[model samples]
Target: MVLGALGVCALVLGWRALDLQVLQHDFLARQGDLRNLRTEPLAAHRGVITDRANRPLAVSTPVTTLWANPREVLAAREQWVKLSNNPVLNSRTLSQRVEANAGREFIYLARHLAPEQAQQVLDLRVPGIYALTEYRRYYPAGEVTSHLVGFTNIDDVGQEGIELSMDNRLRGTPGRKKVVRDLHGRVIQDIAVLEEAHPGSNVTLSIDLRLQYLAYRELLAAVTRNRAAGGSAVVLDARTGEVLAMVNQPAYNPNNRSGVQTAALRNRAITDVFEPGSTIKPLTVAAALESGLVSVNSTVDTRPGTIRVANKTIRDHRNYGVIDITTVLTKSSNVGTTKLALAMEDHALPAFMEHFGLGTATGIPFPGESDGMLPIRSRWRDIETAALSYGYGVSVTALQLARAYAVIANGGIKVPLSLEKVDQPPQGERIISAEHASALVSMLETVISAEGTARRAKVPGYRVAGKTGTVHKLTAAGYADDRYVALFAGIAPAEDPRIVTVVVVDDPQGQDYYGGLVAAPVFGSIMAGVLRTLNIEPEQPVGTYAGVIDREGRL
Candidate 1:
């Protein structure tokens, strides 16, 4: 009976071996392969961001991330301890992580290390340690282009600015490949790639690095010299409506944002809004001209330099008695603008401003772009209308103000603004009659004359047409008497407009808080550089000002 039982046991064991090896062969083989074979991600390089001239603004650099199988690392004991010697890896933290993830097969040991640095760790020959290739974003222009080009996160995802707006286009798809690993979880054999990685497509922005540098330098100097809170400047190709340069003061370096203030990260030119002050006068005059209620030759009486609207009293710098419409804008007269606004039909002014791109988005591909507030009321109050005329009761960003001037520069056409390079000039909607636009440009030229408010805004060889604005910053207690926003918006080579620029210096301290004193000089300096950089020919002799009134009021 013992012999029979032993023989039966051997038969049963043979049958079980056959069943295991033959019946479940594929399933068992798959389970075994799962332990040794793995699918690894192949990092894709992000696209290059460049200026219109193809200068690199942002690029990606190769990096290495070191990872290890926690179980293997803990098992290696002494071998793992050697890794703690590297400065980037904390000994206690590493030990804690490995111990906590003791059952896991993978954990990051060090991320985004330079290849040379990662090689030093690999040379130690730890059993479970391995390196994976990755890419990190690098800004070539640093803080100069930080506000616009933006920065990305450690995972190569865009976090702000253009990087965030165009993320999907800039971040390419990651590929995958199969690899065989040893028991310690180290890659041992190369396997076939399941997919190939495609690098992201390049982005070409309308920004001119040369002009960007010019704008950045000048804006920084003005902000520092004036001891201002912050500022923004925008330069646009008037004919094409493409942004040549856009910069903000209090900029933060995107490459290294260790302790950057949250406020410094904002692209203020497009994101922040303020009452445009006297900068809106030119638009107000345009509205009046379009309404046929006023003419360039028409005059408004300024008697005692102040006027009453409801419970508010509007005042100019001083009493000039009476002034023409052109003089109204040249002087940035609140009384004159109020007269113009009060004479027009309530809806007329707002409708005209809307046509000029106020209260609307410029359609530029940027994150956090604010469409400035243009109030709509079923019934208009005299005070509201007057305030709207002189650039209150409404708000605008520096970019929107630049675009409004571009309409007059582009001969009444309102072209869509573009952040990217434009191969062709875009079609534009006609906001005003070209005749009226030309007439307005001619009137604005007087503002840069010797006797006008923005005399300092003049470029030596070109006829500049612009307006000056100094607005009391509105606070919770109402308009702050001590704080001001100095602004200058202009078109260069006014006869044949090429570029439109707007400079906004907020809360300028000291006695020089007026737009003509603070912002106009910045406008002149930047416009001069831009005009020369574009190789635009001079329209007149450098020192000559024919047909322009002299400081003595003599033509």
Candidate 2:
């Protein structure tokens, strides 16, 4: 009888627990009904950019943004009033801030807010205020890859660089949550969902940091030494068209994007145009040789240091009368080169210029790439033809000029330049004969030797072949005084050419305009640094080879 009484007590207790929980469950849930109705954004992370070895170049870090539900604040007006009394609040007049945001369902307090500031706001215990998460892009290389990595706005939207070009791919759709809520202001469960957030894919670049730094330091030193307004450098692998380095002076840090002048942000390599000057002579010579108008040994009469065509007189930079075609390049004899270009058919000259990749965009992956102006044949006056022969009256961007030399370095085949790696470059169409390219290389090599104008560009262990150009800057009115573009385009280890590096120094203020003194030294210095960084063994021992070296097998 006693055991039965204990069992009866246990059953009674169980019944009472069930009565409170199961029988009254609906009533309790009703009290917390709308709690589950809160809507939250599901954001996807942006992709990281890395080098081939997965070394970070661009990265993203999570940052917080503060916002508010105006309706909730309105309901808790007493708490909001207490919040309004804070002195550090942004609004000068709390009444105006409350009024502007009074009727709205949502209002953004601030974005990418500092955590300490956010904590202060949270400590106020304002009813509707909340924080959301977002990603901010950071370029680790700083100004080093600023031109390539670009930047984005606070909204996680791309405004420039790879971010702008790949905005569609880099930016992901944000997901949202919806739910049903009871009158008691508590959500029950999720009701519907769509547009799932997906993270962006990784983007890899062809740029090598080692080679990039090499070019950067060398070019920076050149501009400082020459007292130049600006400088640009490019290194392209001749075999694959892989762009190893794209360096520029006056580079801006992507980290600080405020109040930046447009000029400082410009990519001089692809955007700025200048007269190509004497660097253009090789193309003219190639056309002449290809068309059988001249041979490497053929001579031209460069008499009196000048030649008259129509009303204009073309003058050699300095006279070397009756020089061979090779000697024309060695001495930079403009009169001989012009005479050679004039010998070709007018139509063929333009065709050859087009073949050399002038007056076209190089199709580099960058924003605002200018397709430099190449005047039509109809615009050519007689003087224009002769002047064009020596690189004047025609504006070409640094990219177009570099690609033109790349064609020569690539064994007369024109391969499209790429910022990204290629499994294989499509078989490029032959633009010039191999024989003509070989002849041009021979002439160009002399330019880096003691007999040539660009002797300063010679590398001790390497046989370097290239052209030096010094052109006058054009003013709105016409050509101006004392301003010049000094440029050098060359391939190193000429016996087995690899990277074709081009260096352009704009408007040096110093006493030198000759590319030898201004741009060629920059080229030599950059190439040497690149070789050392890449662990490319020198062709000679320390202080062994001074100039030309016969083609030798590498270790």
Candidate 3:
């Protein structure tokens, strides 16, 4: 009976072994693989950002991030002390994190580590610790191009400027790969790639690095010299409407932003708006000229240099008995511009200003760009009409002002502004007759002459056409008596214009707050450098306008 019972047990055990090994082999293998296999991420390289000349503005560098399977790490608590020996990891903090997340599968140990440093930590061969190849963004131009190129977060995400605008094009898709790991959670075997990483496409901007540097340096100097709150400078290609250079003062370094102020991050050229002051005179005069209400030779009388409308008084610096329309712009006469606007149909001035791109966004892809305010009223007051004509009721950005001047520079055609390299000249909208535009350009040239408001804006070898603007900063209490925004907008080599630049010095302190005193020199200095850098031929003959004033006090 005992022999029979033992033989029965042996038979049952053999049958059970066969069932386990042969029938369930596939299921068991999959269960084991689940514990050892992982679908790891393959980080894709971000795109390069460059200037129109292919000079790198922003680039990415490879770095390593250390992570761990907390459960696996907690199992090997002895190794935690070993990790603490490395400067990057703290033993107490590591223990607390491991304990707090004891049930979890993963946690970050360290991030953005130098390859060499990460290698050192990995060489210790700590259990459950792993490294991932990641990227960190770097700006080569530093603060000089910070406001334009912008900066990315630690995870390589763009936050501002062109970086934010073109984030998708700059950020590539990360890939995936299946890998086998040991019991310690370290990658041990390379498996098959599930998806190939597609690196981001490179971006080429219209910004010229040379011109950007020039703009930054001169703008910084002007801001410091005038003790102004801040400033912006923009240079645009008249032919293509490409932003050759755009810069702002109080810039912050993108690479090291420890305590960067929020205000410093603004791309002021496109984002900030202010009353354009006398800078809008050219457009107002253009409106008058386009309306046929006044000829270029027509004159406005200003016996006392002050005009009153609706109990509001508009005054000029001094009295000029009677001046022609050209002289009106040359002197930046408030009385002259106010009279021109008052003579037009209420809708005519605002409609003409709209054609100049005022109170409208330039359609730049930049973030935080302001449309600026252009009030639309069903009925117009006499004072409101006067104020709008001289740029008080309306507001504009530096870029908007630049584009308006560019329209005049491009012979009354308005091209859409571009932040990227324009492959071909874009079709432009004809906003004004070329005849009137040319006449306006000729009249603007007088502003840089000796007797004009912006004589300091003159470039020695170029016939500059520009206007000076000095506006009291409007506050909640009304126009501030102490604060002023000084402005200069001009076209260089006026005979055949190539570039249009606008300079804004906000709230220049001290008695010298005039645009010609603070902003015009900045414009002249930057234009001189840009003309020489671009190899544009000098249009004015040597000594032609240098200290040579005609009998009529014109260059």
lDDT, candidates in the order shown:
0.90, 0.77, 0.89
Model 1: lowest-lDDT 10 consecutive positions: 546-555
- Which residue pairs clash within candidate 2? 33-186, 33-187, 34-185, 34-186, 34-187, 35-186, 35-187, 36-187, 37-187
Residue ranges of candidate 2 with Cα displaced over 4 Å: 1-35, 74-98, 114-117, 177-195, 545-555
Tens-place lDDT per residue, model 2, 52-133, is 4567777778767767766776676676565555644543343355568888866777777567766666677666667777
Tens-place lDDT digits, model 1, residues 437-504: 88889989999887788887878788889999999999999989899999999998888987999999
Query: Quick one: best lDDT, which candidate?
Result: 1
The candidate with the higher lDDT, 1 or 2, is 1
Candidate 3, residues 1-555, lDDT tens digits: the string is: 999999999999988888778888888889878988889999987899999999999998999998877877777888777767677776777788778888888888889989998888787777878899999888889998999988888788889988889999999899999999886567889888999888888999999999999999999998998899999999999889999999998899999999999999999998999999889989999999888998878999976999998898889889987999999988888898899899999789988888889989999888999998888889888899899888898999999999999999999999999999999999999998898889989999999887788877878778889998999999999999999999999998889987999999999886689898889989988998999999988876756656743323345
- In terms of lDDT, which candidate is stronger, 1 or 3? 1
**Candidate no. 2 TM-score:** 0.87
RMSD of 2: 6.0
- Backbone clash pairs for candidate 1 read none
Q: How far is 11's C-alpha from truth in model 2 (Å)?
A: 21
Give the per-residue Cα lDDT of candidate 2 at 171.
Answer: 77
lDDT for predicted candidate 3 compared with the true structure: 0.89
Q: Please list the residue runs of candidate 3 whose C-alpha ends up more than 4 Å from where it truly belongs after superposition.
A: 1-28, 183-185, 540-555
